[model samples]
Target: MEYMDMYKKWLEFDEDTRKELEGLDEKEIMERFYKELEFGTGGLRGIIGAGTNRMNVYTVRKATQGLANYIKKQGIENPSVAIAYDSRLYSDRFAKEAALILNANGIKTYMYKELRPTPMLSFAVRNLKSTAGIVITASHNPKQYNGYKVYWSDGGQVTEEHAEGILKEITSIDYSDIKTMEFDKAVDLGLFNYIDDEVEKDYVELVKGLTVNWDVVERVKDTLKVIYTPLHGTGNKPVRRVLEEIGYKNVYVVKEQENPDPNFSTVKYPNPEEHEVFTRAIEMAKELEADLIIGTDPDCDRVGVVVKNKEGEYVVLTGNQTGALLTHYILENLKATGKMPENGVVIKTIVTTEMARKIAESFDVEIMDVLTGFKYIGEKIKEFEEKKDRKFIFGFEESYGYLAGDFVRDKDGVIASMLICEMAGFYKLKGMSLYEGLMSLYEKYGYFVEDLKSVTLEGIEGSQRIKEIMEMLRMEPPRDIAGIKVKEVKDYLKGIGDLPKSNVVQIILEDESIITARPSGTEPKIKFYFAVKGKDNAEAKDKVKRIKDEFLKHVKL
Candidate 1:
């Protein structure tokens, strides 16, 4: 079995791996070797280390070999892959290892020399017309973590079918069976190529083209003071360039967190979704009297925002709020410029706030819902482009990921950052802050409050607990919660609504609130999503409280 085989490999490992194996206790050893680091639908993601269950050069090579084989099986001539890396520890090394494996298989490689964002890698896939692409970064995962994401020729994350096929090849192949070559020799053979600054240049131009209100941005550039932080990731250069190119003159960067650091020394977590990630940026904003602050995660696919409310205090805006704000800005500007399409479509994750639907309806643009994950949004964008049915005006999720225009298939924080700055300036010219804009939307569309929480359960016992939770919900559906009747329960595993099968459930309450529960595929956790609407903020808060309390009580986890 692979378990003992990997244990034997550990025994025969080189100096570093042998040391790592010796350091672990029996339980740790089993945990590390009981299973290979799964090449899941999202590719290989785990703690970066020596074990088979961790993301190391060996594991990365194995995944890449599988990807290369898949490309070869497609019978595409001169197959090539584009690779990029973030600033996480060993990310660059892992990326190079992947390229080496792909090169060993006669697949050409186009790689960025320095760290870049996930979205940039997506752009590279389309720009180079590569057969597939790879990015080595954990996104917002903690310092102990690192990841390798694979994208197809479609410029989107590999879909379910491709991932599963590649995973089969990865899982069946022996660890030593993965092919690799010396980096220098690969380069000499022209199998490994470096993507030049031209990619970054074109990427910036592409994102700038997504801007909705350039004239308004220029008008308010000088008067509007803003703070931006990349949180030590790939967003620094591109984000700043787009803002500067669009006439954001008074933009200020948080000096302390400007450069990339693998440990994310300034904050415990590098995720923009967390308010603490904006600590230094917030301090700088207050000192500079900036009206708004924006931050992006390490890989730069997600953006978080902070705005000065009417009370003059800086408050973090939820992903839902930011999505709604961007949706409003883009639609309003399009209509103002007479660029609104009669059948433009906006896309959001099914779990994202319904407020987006209401906003799209107000603008007469059709809004469609997809399963969670930005790849679905990208899938729709590709579909629209192919069918020529409806134009994709915007795509977003509740986790701060957003995309506009068809340039890049993935959610792009670089573009989101530029547009948010421009949107803030548009309102500042009218003597209102971003908070005011959000409040106005709430007033117009009722208060649609949303919340998300993850309950982590680790290892073998923990997985059973997660399974129990899902089974419990399916076997005994709740008919009422806090006196709110349940209207329907949609088990996504049964393949509901034309979406691919997944382990998710959407519970629609009688009052139209939604509660979704699903086990996270990428982490050892189960995520719960809540979206509640009410007449006012207070009422929304109360309903959220009651629903969450009663719902959790029913689950009894």
Candidate 2:
């Protein structure tokens, strides 16, 4: 009945929404209005459509109203917000709607003049000293989806406590109570302002400054052939500019994917994690005889890489692989240049490869393992600032997200791409490819491989099934997986030692092999992560497969 009410309310919308909903079947109507689009810790994300469960102007305004109310309660005199959007459909419109709604609620808004990557929004929040920030992007989700991610003045995703407060405020307000002003009126009233390119220049300069050895890059600038693709998102301009200005003359952009396209015409999805997203870039690399390829997701928060093996075939690197390689390079360079600190630390998620730990230890740098999300890593960065106990060297997760500096609290592809190019250049100077660099890391550390498998469960019933699966695993926990004895079980929900409580479980084997299961916070899926190390590459991969196959038997997929 509630869904039916929302369906009726949404039908009173504009002509396009009304016409779109007029012909929906009963199932379609229920699917679109069964419940409000979830505003989780990640903020609002959903398929763009006409109902309460979809991402539309009404929902965006409602969320903004809630955020405004929360800000007012914080007692910040004349609070402000920074806003940015990506190339997704309706992203710009949603961003403008949010800004105006904030303006109507008596808050100043600093919005980007055009589409930009998510990390820039993070930087803008701190640079502009705004009360909060919002970026309209779904990250790497399909084209049907768009999102609104909120960040505090710290330039990181809103804290869990903040998420709860905003949610309470959101629930108290009715959809009809949402306020907004015209864009022109907001601009005239001095409540709305556009951020200029100077901020971009500042951001690019900071990224370029992260280069470890520009001397090597300059030497290999003309010889190192690099291919890059933005995946039709927001990374094209900034990434290209940073590389070019930093002295890479042989960089080639994938022409077909260089510009914004909401449809993501050439790939199944804009996710760099999927090999399919690199088809165009790989072709360009092979034709150009490039040494390396890089691709970033839609919002450019996460990045992926491809490198030529000794056999001259392009091999895609997993997020863990890239993170490991970058870790080794950064630490090695720091020590060589005598910039290594006594208290430097490397942070990674619990599900990431243990190779990061091994690599950090080899360099005598401490490795800190946080919870799965990058926000926890960001929280640690904030903690480091207040305590000044440890200096952050690098942070990454298993999902292609990485960060080297604390200038931006979130994962940054712009900086990651720049460092990756520098790393490749450093290797080229030694007559080795990035693949051979990875091989050397494995040679020193044991061979480690990781795999991630996701089982998507959609709709109301599917959500229930997901809950059931999780409960079963917790109640009857696996004693052993694939003949390896279970050494210990870490149930993150019960609140691990110092980490926040989360709905995730990990079974550690006697051999130190690890398996983690958790429901995705941003999508309707439960992801399983397997990490194992063995004497060689084939053994490591085979152990992962065996462990994954055996673990799936315990849960109903």
lDDT of 2 by residue, 65-114 (tens): 99999999999987999999999999999999999999999999999998
What stretches of model 2 exceed 4 Å from their correct place? none
For 422-526, candidate 1 gives per-residue lDDT tens digits of: 899888898899999999999999899998878989787888999998998898989999899999999999998798888998899999999999898777789
Write down the lDDT of every candidate, Cα atoms only. 0.89, 0.91
Q: Which pairs of residues clash in candidate 1, taking residues 3 or more apart in a chain or in different chains?
A: none
Candidate 1 lowest-lDDT run of ten: 1-10
For candidate 1, give the lDDT of residue 293: 94
- How far is 324's C-alpha from truth in model 2 (Å)? 0.3
Please give each candidate's TM-score. Answer: 0.98, 0.99
Backbone clash total, candidate 1? 0
